[model samples]
Target: MYFIPNENLDPTLNLAMEQYILSGLNLDEEILFFFIDRPSIIVGRHQNTIDEINLDYVKAQDIQVVRRLSGGGSVYHDLGNLCFSFILPFPNQPVPDFSSFTEPVIRALRTMGVPAEKSGRNDILVEGAKISGNAYYHNKFGTVCHGTLLFNTDLTVLARALNPKPEKLSAKGVQSVRSRVTNLNGYLPGIKTTVEFRERLLSEIARDAKTIELSDADLANAEGIADERYRNPLWTFGTSPKYTLKRTRRFPIGEIELRIEVRDNIIRDVVFFGDFFTSQEIDPIVDALRGSELETGALTAALRSIDWKAWFPTIQEEDFAAFVAQGD
Candidate 1:
C-alpha cells in the first residue's frame, strides 16, 4: 500500500482529489489517504438533500454542504473529524463486504485500547455508540472505500445540522442523532489532539507503506474538477433520482401549494393549488418552470422573467423563487 499526504480543509477539493487519485491515476497497487475538513455536511450520492439536511440551520451556520460519490446517510465533519479512503482493485465478486475494509481500523483502534467493533452493515461502534460510518464507490478503475471517524466532533451541532426523517429515526429506535453517536477523545489512552490520533492511526494501519506526494499538475487538475463538479449546485442538489415535491406555504395574501415533479434534475411538471386568489391565468407561471432546473439560479432566472405579483398581488419574485427552490 502507498500513502498520500493531504492537509487541505476544503471539502469539495478533498472529494475531487479522491476522485482524481482513484480514476485519474493508473495504479496497480492499493493507495491510502486521509483528510480533514472544516465544518461541513457530506451527503450521499443517492439521497435527496432536501430530506437529509436542515437547510435553514446549515445555511445560517455557514456550513459547507457537498455530495459524496458513495451511498449512505449524510454525515457532519469538522476539524475534529478524521476521514480515510482506500483505493484498491475490485474483489472477484464485488459484493458489499464492509467487514473486510473496516476490520483494519477496528484492529488499529484496539491497539490504542479503544474497544471499537463493526456493528451493522457499515458502521463502527464503540460501547454500542457509533464512531465511524463507511461507504463504497465502484468504478472502472477499482473500488473506493471511504469512511469518517468521529474523534472529537461536536455532537450538538451534528444533531442540529442533520434532519433525518422521523420515520428513519423511529425505525432505528433512536430519538435523536446525539443518542446514537460518540467521540473517541475520551476513549483514547494518551492521544492529546486529533492530529496526534491521526498520525498514530496511520502508523498502525500501514507500518511499512511507501509515502507518495502529489505533484503540482495533480493539484491543479483536482482544483479544476472541484470547481466544475463539486462546487456546482447542480451536481450537489440536482443529481438525485426522480421525485415529487409538494410544498404548501401561507403568504399574506393566502395559502399556496406547489406540486413539482422532477426527473434527472429538470422540472418535468408543475401544478399550483390552494385558496389563493389570482386575477390572471396561472398557466404562464407553471409553464415557466416546466423545463427549468431545480436550482436557485435556474429557478430565479425563470421566475424573474415573469411578474409574480400579477398572480399573487402580495408575493415578490425573489421570495417565490426561494420558496420553490428551498429544501424544506
Candidate 2:
C-alpha cells in the first residue's frame, strides 16, 4: 500500500478527506490512504449521538467525536491505532458487498503473522478477540469502508469513549460491552509501537495499490466540503432525521415469533413468543434498533444481518418485518 503520511491528526479533517475520495472515485483511480491520528470517537450514520457517546470524557480529553457516513456502532481511534481508506471505482460495477472488501485487511493480517478471521459478520478477530471492526458508507459515487486496527492503543480511552446503553448500566460503571472486546496489542508479544505495525500493514495493502497523490485541487475540494458541510453543527449534532415507529408483543409468523414495539426507529417494546433466546445484551441491540429510520427494507436488512443467536434467537427476517409492518 502507498503511504500518504498524514501530518494532520484532526479526525474530522481526515474524515472529510475520505468523503472527498468517495464522491470522486474515477474509473482508473483506486487510492489507499494510510493516515495516523490521536484518540477520538467516531459514531456511525444511524446511531443516536447522545446515547452512544460520553461527551464529558471526550471533551475533557479534547477528543473529537465525528459522525461517519456508515451504519454501525461507534469506534475509538488514536495514535496507537491505524486507519486505512480505500477509494475504488464505483461505476456500472456493483459497489462491493461489505464482506467482500474486508478480505484485503484479513489478507494483510496474515502477512503480519496473525491468524485473523472475519467473525460475527463485521469483526476481524485474532484468537477470538477482535483486532478490528469494519463499517461501510455507500454514497452515489461508490462505497468507503474504514475501521481501526487497535495495535498498542489505549483501551481505557475506548472504555471512556463508548457510553453503554441505559439498560446496560447500573450504579457502577458500564457493565456490558466491557468484557467482550480486547486491545489489539494483547496479541503481539514484541511489537511495542503501533507505528511499526502500521507501516508493515501499509506496505502490504499498497503493494499494487496505485499511488495517486491528492492534488492541491483534491485537498481543496475536501477542505471546502469539510468547512461548509461536515464541520457544521447542522450536519453534526443537530441534523438527525425524525421518524415514527411501532412494535408488537408476542406475535407469530410461521414457527418464529416476536413481542416487539417500535418508536422513533427503535424497538420500544419486545416480547418472546417461541423458544428463542435473545441475548442478555438485548437491550443495547434494542437501543440500536430504536430511533431507527423509517426505511423498512434497511431495518429488515439489519435484522436479517445480525447473528440472531447472539441477540435475538431464531428470528426470521420476513416474519420480523411483517410483524413490524403489522404494527404500522
Q: Tell me each candidate's TM-score.
A: 0.73, 0.70
Q: Encode model 1's per-residue lDDT on 1-328: one tens digit a residue.
A: 9898998999999999999988777766788989999999998764567777899999999999998777667899999899999877543335346787899999999988999999756789999899999887776667788999999999999999999766556645788898989999999858877789889999999988899898999999999999999999997787443349977665544346677898888889876644333434578998888899888788878987888666655676767777888844
- State model 1's lDDT: 0.82
Best-performing candidate as measured by lDDT: 1
lDDT of 2 at 25: 37
Q: Residue 227 of candidate 2: its Cα lDDT?
A: 88
Model 2 Cα lDDT, one tens digit per residue, 1-328: 3334565777777888888776753545666776666787777654556666788888899887777666556778888888877666464455565567668888887877778888754667777666687776554576666767878767877887788554433312336555545666665665677777776777777766545567889888888887876677656565333334324233221112344455655555543222121213344555544545435675676565555444444556655555565653
Pick out the ten consecutive residues of candidate 1 with the lowest summed lDDT: 272-281
**Candidate 2 ranges beyond 4 A from true positions:** 1-5, 25-27, 166-175, 239-328
lDDT of 2 at 289: 48
